[model samples]
Target: MKYLSDQMLIEVYHRAVDLQLDSAFIELLRSELDHREIRIAQVSA
Candidate 1:
C-alpha cells in the first residue's frame, strides 16, 4: 500500500467502493490514506 502513489490510492479506494467490496477492506484503504495524511474533498449539499 505504501508503494502506491497518492492518486493510485484514491483510485483504489473509489474502485473498492464502486465494487461494493468488504467494509474491512475499505477501512484498510482509509487507514492507509490517513497514514499518508491524504485528504479527499467532500461535497455538501
Candidate 2:
C-alpha cells in the first residue's frame, strides 16, 4: 500500500510538471502527496 501510493505520488508529481496540469488538479495532487508522505513517515517511524 505504501509503495503503491508513493509510486502514484511520484507519477502524479511528474505528470503535473511535465504536462502542466491545472492548478486545482495539481493542488489536489499535492494534497494527496502530503497525506501519503505523512502516512509513509508514520509507517517508517
Q: What TM-score would every model get versus the actual structure?
A: 0.84, 0.59
Instruction: For candidate 2, give the lDDT of residue 14.
Output: 66
lDDT of 2 at 35: 78
Residue-level lDDT of model 1, residues 1-45, one tens digit each, is 979999999999888887888889988998998899999853121
What ranges in model 2 sit over 4 Å off?
1-4, 38-45
lDDT of each: 0.84, 0.61
Going through the candidates in order, what is the number of backbone clashes in each?
0, 0
Candidate 2 on 1-45: residue-level lDDT in tens?
Answer: 355557777676666666777777766766777876633322110
Q: List the residue pairs that clash in candidate 2.
A: none
Write out the backbone clash pairs for model 1: none
